[model samples]
Structure formats: structure tokens, C-alpha cells
Target: MSVTETTVSSPLPPGKYYFSGNEALAEGAIAAGCNYYAGYPITPSSEIMERLAARFAGLEGRVFIQMEDELASICSVIGAVWAGAKGMTATSGPGFSLMQEAIGYAALTETPLVLADIQRAGPGTGQATKVASGDLMQAKWGSHGDYQPIALCPWSVQEMYELTITAFNLAETYRVPVFLLGEEAVGHLQERLDIPAANRVARRHYQPGAPPFGHPDPAGVPSMPAFGQGEKLLVTGSTHDEYGFRRTDDPAAHARLVARLNDKILQHRDRIVSTRSYRLEDAEIAIVAYGFTARSAWLAVDELRRAGKKAGLLRLRTIWPFAAAEIAALGSSVRQIFVPVPPADRRPDHLPGNHHPGGTGAVAWPATWKNTCARAPTAPRSVPAAATAS
Candidate 1:
């Protein structure tokens, strides 16, 4: 069976503790009332599953299972959540790829689940232990349909804990899948994390006997009923009516289903998307970044300021729904905006003044840079200094 009994400690108490991003994510999942964990071990993300495996043991009503693969891992989480349990799973790059189809399935069914992707360098297993922010695009478009995704990028171990809880809350609130995108460097890096005495968690809305598929309001989230709740639920990835009847041949039915899915998040994007500004006020140059690179970029801005340059940092905490308004706001104030990318990314097409392929107009992405906390200042200087000379 998936449930097993063993002697282990209960959930962590409120206090400061040293934790890797993966460990903090496990604790954060617990804090968010996640009682179901299912995943296969993958580098940079295995610790989350391992810790939950130990912690879930002997805890009443909690379940932990080592699934056969990533597909099973995500599918099982979807099942657990529908059974009225808060569920989560963790994985790295390749495993994230495997989970994509199910992610799309979850979106169509409006399943509330949290997925932590501890990112590693890769197109196809390029470097399992190395850090990369390459999955930023995949997290949104990996699935085959036109569904909106909520993705958060945690730059440090502290955020790894807090944002996992936020991810769960957002998922339940919107009745959609949410992603916590963590880079390998931050996932393995140990740092201080403070557990608060109490956290506010959002529970799913359930209106028993009401239709669970379509909402009366176009941008509304429908009430989700658990499997054994006697609601006569008919969940499917195919197009269905508000009463959950299959309507495959009806174009109107398909359009309504698809539009609601996108509208729910689109209308709520302002609240769902999050960003932080460091030294942006009254600055001439701005650097946009996310994930672990944001930490390096923060240091770069500080170094530039010390050298009497007006540099600022805009760190994207939520990536999907793509932070357009924030980037557009920066464009109005800054003379130039630099998005520090890894040296391996040589896409000049992603530069400033070029339309983003994703259609966020003029979203600037620097051509390339070598990133590390120690060498952070070099990247900020290299690009902007050349622009200044011309």
C-alpha cells in the first residue's frame, strides 16, 4: 500500500533552522497542510521527497509513496487532492518534462496541486548537478493546450519554504496547478529559514450538489467536490458542460471551457503575479532577473551603486502571467534594462526592443553572461558599460 507506518518526528515547530531549498520546501509543504506526497527521486530535488517520506511516516492521515516514475508521481498527487488531501510532488529537469502532460490534465480538471521543480542545466541531461534557469519557458508552455499556469521562482532557501506554502495557497484559491521553480544552486544551498508560529492557508471551496466544472462568472473558480463526497463527479480532460456532460462535438462548449480557464488567471493576474524592486527608485539602468540569478543580480546592483552608477534590480517572484506590467513600468523610468542570462543562452532575438516570442512586447533579455555570486558585478558592468560608450 502507499501508506506505511514508522517511528519518526512530527512536523517541525516554529523556529529558525538551517535548511537546503529542498528541505525547506518539504517543511513548507507540511506547513501548508500537505498530507500527501508522491514522487520519484531526482537529483537536486530528491531531498524533498526523502524528508517527506520520513515525516509522513506514523503521522495519522498522512501518505507518502514512491511512485514508479514522474508520470505516476504527478497523477497520484492529482488523485490524492481529489480525495480531499492537500498534495505535492518534487522533481528536477527531466522529471519535470515527464510531468507536463499530467500538468495539462490537472489544469483542465481544475485540480489543486503543488509541483516543485528543482531546475538543473539541461536540454537533454546537460548537467544534472549544475544550475540553470532554462525551465522558465517550459513551466508555462510544456503542456499541449491553452491553459494558464502559476509559477513562482524562489531565489533563496528562505523563499523556498515560504513560496511552497504560497504555491499551495494559490493552487487551492484558483483551483489550478502551481509550480515552484527552484534552480539547482539554491536547491542545494543551505541557509537560515525561520518558521513562523502560524501561517494562513487557503482551503478549496466546495459547494456540494452544485456543478463542479464551469463557473457562473466567466472568470470565477467553480466549487470542487472530493471523489467520495457523493456529488456524482465526472472529471475529464475533454471539453464538458457545467454539469460535467461530455460535449466533444460542440464548438461553443469547447470555447467556453478554454476561455474560463485562461480568464480565471488573466483577470486575477495582478494579485497572482509578484515582484520585488531593489534600488529601482531614481535609477537610470535596471536589471531584471529571477531564481538564483536574482541573488547574483542583487549583488551586482550593489556593486554598481558603489562604483557611482545608478543600477537597480527587479526580481520576478512570479514568472508566469509573465510580469509584463512591472517590466513595462521599468521601461518608462529606466534608460536601459538588462536581463542577465546564462552564458549558454545566445539568443540575441530576446534582446531589448525585440518582441518576446511569448508576445510580451519588448521584454528585454540580455544576450549572455556568466553568473555566480562572486562574479555578479562583472555581468552588470560588461553590458551597460558598452552601451554608455556608444
Candidate 2:
């Protein structure tokens, strides 16, 4: 597949313009009602901070700070958001590891914020410039706990532009931290992004002069009062009740608070999860993939179908609430499911034992079917030639 050029027929509005993935992220933050950004420079992710710094330089009612480290960076952003400003921070894998504790804090406190992890190869600083989807497991379980986070993976430049906006909206609407799970390729790739006008940008609004945590609507999402709104607010990481105060020693309070945080995202998974399907109606075999791997799978599927095989592609855009229902529906008719694992240092040894040799490479599939419904161990699987016909 070829990279398409992004075109612009007209100039942008006063404060809006076309941008690349990096610039699109910055613009999305601005559109999402973000007024403050704090982050440290890291490869494959620094562009987000750079663009925000330049754009927020002269804007009133906005601030951008370059902190000493990723820990302080995330801490400051959380503080700013609670103080009544929409806040965000960006970093790569190693830095993301550093921010795990703080991210858990944000999740527990119900702080609405956006986090962008432009992923790179790593268990620990493995490769700064190389691209890999190694962070899939990390993004879901990075911050040690049972919390559901709204995570969106963008495969192209345009999605990086659009999904970042959606991430922030999800954060505010659900009162949870939303993640923009970007890969190095998408982050660095330059493409034309048609940014929507200011009025077209969707932003969550607080009830006029509403008190902090004051229920505004049935969605359980309150209109957040900005800091200095003269509203007395309590924010803490410990298990808290509806009012956001700490309930340190109470087991029941902890249970209810924890359940609420998890349910807030899981109950609304239908609204938060999205996937792109191709030729699924008649497919007899399906390939499940996400992010950059989805692109390769799409190509493979098209080649297979042209050779008179029934194959389809399921591309997951929302990675975290794992689109299980959609995958189950797609898998119902298919005989086999091919999950392409990108080239990595640690090969998954649990695949089912079915293998076929291609001209120069061998296509393998797992032997036993592991339903995504349960947290089953990864099993060895096989990919039939019909599934990779080309």
C-alpha cells in the first residue's frame, strides 16, 4: 500500500489549520478544551510536546511546562487538571513506565485527563527509533490494578488527528484517563489532516457555575468546575466516595469506589469501542489485528480473497475494552483466526502447532482456539494457506 498525500483546498480558520500527526495531536488537545500541557522530551513522542509549546506560547489562559522528568511531568498535569484546567502529557515506553504509579493515581481519583504514549520497542529502552507494537500489554496493564481505561490506537496520520480529540472527550465524559496509543511510524509520518473548524470540535462543558462533582446529567459525568471557581473540592488517590474525599481504612468504600471506576468504562464499552471491518459478510477465515499490523493484515486478506479464498480483516481502533463481541461475531463463521505477531525479540511460544511454508517465509497459526472472553493462556495456532492465499 502507498501513503496517500493529504490535500487542502482552502486555508484554515483563524485558530485552525491542517497539520501532521504531531501537530494534529496538539490541535486535538486544544480542541478538546485542554489549556495546560506538562511533559518531558522523548523520541517518537516529543513532537506532541513541541507543537503544544509553540502553539500555547502566546495564548492567554494557557500554560506549558517542560518538567525535569516523566514522573513530575504527569504529576504536574494531574494537578493542573484538578485545578480546573483540561490537562495532557506525552511520553514513550520507558517514560510511560515511570508514570505508571501517577497514572494509577489519576485513575483512582477519577481525574479526567488525556495521555499519549507514542510507543517504541522496549522491555526497557530497547530501541528508541525502531517501531513496534510491543506496548499492547503495557497500555492495558501498565499501571498495576483492575481499572479500565479508554485507549484508542491510530494506524494512520488522519486517525492520529481525529482520535486524539475523541480520547479527551472520552476522558471528560467518563471521568477517566483516556490514552492515545500511537506507534512511532504514525507519530513521525507527515500527512495532510483536514482539521475541523473550532465550532465543529466537540468539547465537554461544565454546568455554568456548577460545584465540583455536582451531578449535571444522567451520564454520571459532571460538568467540571475549573480551578478557582470558589468550589470546595477534595481530590485524593485513596479510595473515595462520590464526593472525592479519601476513605483510607474503609474496605466497603474501597470496594464500591473501585467497582464504580471499572464499571464507568466497561458498562459503556459499546460507546467507547470501535473497529473497522473489511469483507466480513462472506469470509470463511478472518485475521484479527490492530494498529500498524492491521495494515499488513488488510493487504494479506485482499490478496487471499483475490486467489478465491474467503478471508476478511478486523481492524481494532479501540484497543482497551478489547472488542470481544465484535471479534466473536466475526469469528462465528470463520474456520480459523490469524493473529499476526510483529517481529519481536520475545517470540510468543504458546501458539497452536499448525505451519505451512511459503516461498521464503513460513505462515503459522495456533492449534487450539482460545476464546477472547476468558483470560486464557496464549495457545499455539495455525494459519491455513487459504487464509494467506497470496
Candidate 3:
């Protein structure tokens, strides 16, 4: 059968429908006005590319290319973005690793793009089908630079759809790369997705003479000009002046450019970081979590409350530009904090449960947890790891 006819609602219309998280993410990209997609097929994330290809096949002005590898896929997406098209790519852990260099380049150039990472078990090609939130640290620090990235974590199929659109909007607004971090479980889970009739999409503003790489305000986002726009634009990954001239050995220029790239996102973090509180108002204990684990954490909070424990949930919708302020605020009012970490996680510091709230803390894990709480360096003085939910 043709991909268009066989796929689930290619270019889905505005309505409620049953969809997998990966499929919903593809539809969300369409709804967000993404016109270019380049990606390699990697298990859980492959479905997103498949859906986008099916949709692009039936549409005009949209492009889809199955790149030979993740390196080529990310490069193509970057090129498309510079060519004035809303572009994106999807990949899993191994592919994500390969794209780090290009991701750093995109950050230095302030390229606006979206990347969906459906994480699987891994340090290096661990398990393709098994679920794990192992890419949490890699998404933030993998590029090896002072650049800041916006990453959103989705806990359900519906969130996978909504957050994908949010990822595009954030990318365009900040002129930076954005990541939609999903896990194998959520990406493959089937659930209801409600599509709205209209979405508030951000459109990149182009001004002819404005400097594409620098602005007077440290946290300001410069107007982006497309390649064929007759503007004398020079794009480079090296340290550069406001006009994008190469400033290889100029320390001042390098410092200024690097600082702005970070401040633009870090200073405006209030707008980029997103979190949702569940029964936090009167609770004495707070459970902070994100991605797939947040789903179980939410349930655990409800169960704790039923047992006369005043428990609450703080769900992290945005992972990067870490919600430090929110976590601190929640900590001040709570007696203890509980954070659920993925079972048998290979990286300890990358664990979401390691966020130190400056209070007594507990690490929640499933029955299969092989790591101890002591391994978490930033975690607050901890009690024994508790078996919370499966």
C-alpha cells in the first residue's frame, strides 16, 4: 500500500483521534508549519519520519528526504532552515550522538530548528526497543560548548503532539535549536490526541540590513535573513563579529558572541522553561519528575494522598534551561522531595532525580533499579531509594 493511504491520518485534520506519540509528533510538526524534514530511520523515532514523509508526499511546498545517516540528516535540516524553510529532524540515542558536532555548529550560528529524540536504552547501542531516559544529559551538554538549548519532555501521546508544536515556536522565537525529548515507551504508546483547529505558530522575522549574528542587547535575538535575500550574509561556526565575519583569533569577538548565544536563552529562561504542578498547593511533600516517569509519579502522588500523605507533583515540561527556580520554590514549601529515576540508568548525573532542592530528598525507582542514591552527586542528602511504581 502507498504510504499516504497506509499511514495514520497523513496531515491529520483538526479533530480528536487515536494516535501513537511518534505519529502525533509528526502531525504536530505539520500543524506548526514545518515545511522541511530530513531524518534517518531509527526504530522508535522512525515512525515520525514515516508519518511526515507520508504527509509530505501528498502536499506541495513540503520536502522530505531520507538522509543516509544522522550527520547528513541534521546538516540538511540546518541548510533548509538557512534557506528560509521551517525545518526539523528526528533520531534516537545513537543518531543523536552523531549529530552533536552539527548541533554545536547550529547553536553557534543561531540556526532555528527542531529535533525530536525518542530515547532508547543506551550508552552505545544498548537496546533499540527498550525505553530509557538516558539522553537527558546528552541533549544539554553533548555539543561541548557554552550554548544553551531548549528541550521539552513529553509524558503522554497528547503532550508529544502539543510539545512538538511548542518546540518549533521556541526555536523560531530564540533563533536556536530546540529538542523534543521522548522515551521509547511514550513514543510507542497509543492514546487520544486532540488537534486544535488553529495553532499559534511563531514566524521568523527577516530584516534586510539587521545583523544576523549579533544585537546590542545581550539577550536580544537578531532578525534572521535568508540566503537568497540579497543580503551580504556570512554564516560561520567560528567566532565572528555582528555581521558574521570570521574572527578566529579575536578573543573579544569570541567572548561577546559566545556570551550572547548563552544569555539569549539563559536570561530569557522564564519564558522558555515550562512546568505543571499537580496538587502542590497544600502538600507537604513534592515529587519532581519529567518525561515518561512523570506519568507514574503523578499516579504515585495520588496514591500517597489517598493514604493521608500530603504529596504533590511538579511535572517538568521543559528540561533544558533547567527549572531551578521552580524546584527551589517547591522545595521551600515542602518537607521533602521525591524524584523518580529510570531503572538501571547508565548515567547517574544525567538522572532527572539528581536535581538538588536543598531539602531532604528521596529517589524513587522501580523494582529493577540497580543504582543506589549515593551515586547521584547533586541530589540532596537522601534517604533510601524507595520502590514507587512500575
Candidate 4:
């Protein structure tokens, strides 16, 4: 057992204890400085809220609210953030579907928050306890409009913990809603997780009189000022000026405001996108995957290698700002690129549907089976990974 020091000079527990992915997510949120968690209980994702409910009982100023419904759940999280607290919420398919409106509000208001979707099979009341990777597309497009979303897909229990912390850091850094897309298998899988020391301290970047929105720091992200901060701020979903005044009727203002929102994420993409290139060097075929489906892809790729076939995997750590350049490069280098999607996602021309907010939808995920998000088989730019990212 060894302890790793973090940026905040806090101490990580120096031992190993078996923990489920959902439990690790709770611990990670706490470590990342999340003090407010409001959520409705949903299968798979319920463990996350449940774990936090018990943990927060002993921590001062930390709150765990079992909201009456997903609507109330998202509202509580948004309210908590406005009051200068780090906020987080966890849910599955149905709850995720219910959260779209608030998700849009978070994006339009540029609220720094984290949402975790421990995906299960869906559309309606799919499997409750069964593992599924169904929410991959919904996490991106479920919210409306043109906004860049930062979504992290974790394949294992370790990644579930690490990525949850990363999601918080990114949410604050970008002043955007960040999503942690965890499949059911990873959410409930028990494994030894070594708790890492706390590193990040959540905070607002506002000065007493600075504008609350519309000013993109050189980093391309606006420094956010929460309510109750000394700054006089007006936060709303309507198109607004940098000073937070609405310009909903002005086409130019509307265009510029929306464009800035998109540009803040797209223009400085490298800062927000992350991917794992596995054995890509000199490989002939590439397996592109994310979330739970990535686990099977890796195994299949590994098995093919033992049989002496050149193979590799491109694991998507960040799905929203999908790794277009990397995927494009693979298109040129590899003889074949395989994306292992679930049977429901197997329909031909399914990639476009996933990319279109109105097209088909993010459906079921594979548990001990193959699940995946589709990339273009030939044209990298033509294929869409997480289409509704904002």
C-alpha cells in the first residue's frame, strides 16, 4: 500500500478495499470537492447516490439530497451550484431522458457541474438491473441546441473513479456540464480501488465586479461567477451579451453568442479531448470503442494478436469532442477498423442515426457482450461518434 500526494496536499487512504464502480464514483466526487449531490434513485446509478447519502452524513456542509424525481434532482443540483457549491448528480436511462431540459440550462448558463449516467438498456423502462451501454448517444444529444459537451466514457472500475474526478475538473475548467458515461458492468463491478488524495478545490473565477459570462479567457472558456458572489450577475438560457444581458431578438447577437459557446469548446478542442491509443504503432486493424463496449473490443483485439493478426484499439476517454483527427489518421493507416456495437445498434446506416439528435437514438449496451458507439467505417470525418455533444 502506497499513498500518492495530490495537488491539494491532502492524504489518500493508504490501503486497498474492494469497491463497486458506483461507490468509487461517490468517493471520487467527494475527493474532487463535490459538496452537493442531489439525485433520484435509479438502478445501477442508485448505488452512487446511496453511497454518497451515507458518506455525507458524517461530513459537514456536504449534502446528499434524494430528490423526489429526476426533474427535482437536476433542479437541486443547479441551485446548489449557483449558491457556490460543487454539484453532482447520477442517473440512468429514464432519469437521463428526464434531465435534458436542465442539461440544456446548464449548458446555456455555462454552469460548472457534473452528471454521471450509469447506462442501462433503455428507450423506456428497459432492463433495470442489467448492464447496458445504451446512453452513449443520449448523454451527448439528450440536451438540445448547439453546445459542446464534455463526456468521459469509462470501461473499468478504476477508470470509473479516475474519470469521475476528471469530469469535475473539466466541468470547472470549461464552465460546462461534463458527463461521465459509465456502463452498468463498470458501475457495479467490484474491484480494489486505491483512493487517491484530493487534488482539486472547486471555486469561482470571478472578481468583485467582473462580468459573469460571455468573456472567454485566452483559454477559450469563460471564468464563471456563481450567485451570491459580489459580482452583479444575470444568468439565463437566452442568448446574452458578455455582461449577461439577453439579446434574444438580435440575430447577430444570437449567432455570435451561440457561436462563442460552440467555439469555446471546439476551437480549443485538444484541451478537452482525451483518448487511449493501444498498440496503434504499426498496427493494421484498429478497434474503435468507448464505455463498456471497449472492454470487449480490447479483449477481441488481444485475442487476435495471439493468433498473430495485427490488431489495435483506440479507446475513447472523451466522447463528446470525439477524437476526429485521431480517428481520421487511423482511417489512412489501418486496413480495417471495426466498431463492435450491440444488436440493436447493428442496423445499417446506424452511425448517422446516433449522430442525429432526432435520428434513431442511443440504445442498449452489451454486458458480457459486444457494445459500441459507431465511427465511420471508411471516412473518419463522415462518421459521428457523440453527435449531440453540446
Candidate 2 lDDT by residue in tens digits, 1-390: 011123222123434345667777777777666788999999989989998898787667889999999999999989998787789999999998999999899888777889999888887888898777777667777798778777888877778877877787777777788888888877887777765554233344566554344243323555555557765667678677666677788998777667767876777889889999898788876877777667677777777777778888888899887776665565456766677655652344321112111221223444332322122114545544433332
Worst 10 residues of 3 by lDDT: 1-10
Candidate 3 lDDT over residue span 128-234, tens digit each: 99888888888888998788989999999999988998898899988899999999999999999998767777777667798888888987888898988899679
In model 4, the runs with Cα more than 4 Å from the true position are 1-6, 9-12, 198-204, 216-219, 348-390
lDDT of each: 0.83, 0.71, 0.83, 0.75
Model 1: per-residue Cα lDDT at residue 166: 88
lDDT over C-alpha atoms for residue 249 of model 2: 89
Residue lDDT tens for model 4, 266-305? 7767877898988889787677788777877787777777
RMSD (CA, Å), each prediction: 5.4, 8.7, 6.8, 6.1
**TM-score of each model, in listed order:** 0.91, 0.82, 0.89, 0.86
In terms of TM-score, how similar is model 3 to the real structure? 0.89
With a 3 Å backbone cut-off (N, CA, C), the pairs that clash in candidate 4 are 133-365, 140-388, 147-390, 149-389
> Which regions of candidate 1 are displaced past 4 Å?
1-11, 346-368, 373-390
Ranking by TM-score: 1, 3, 4, 2
User: After best superposition, candidate 1 residue 46: deviation in angstroms?
Assistant: 0.3
Kindly give the stretch of ten consecutive residues in candidate 2 with the minimal lDDT sum: 351-360
Top TM-score hit? 1
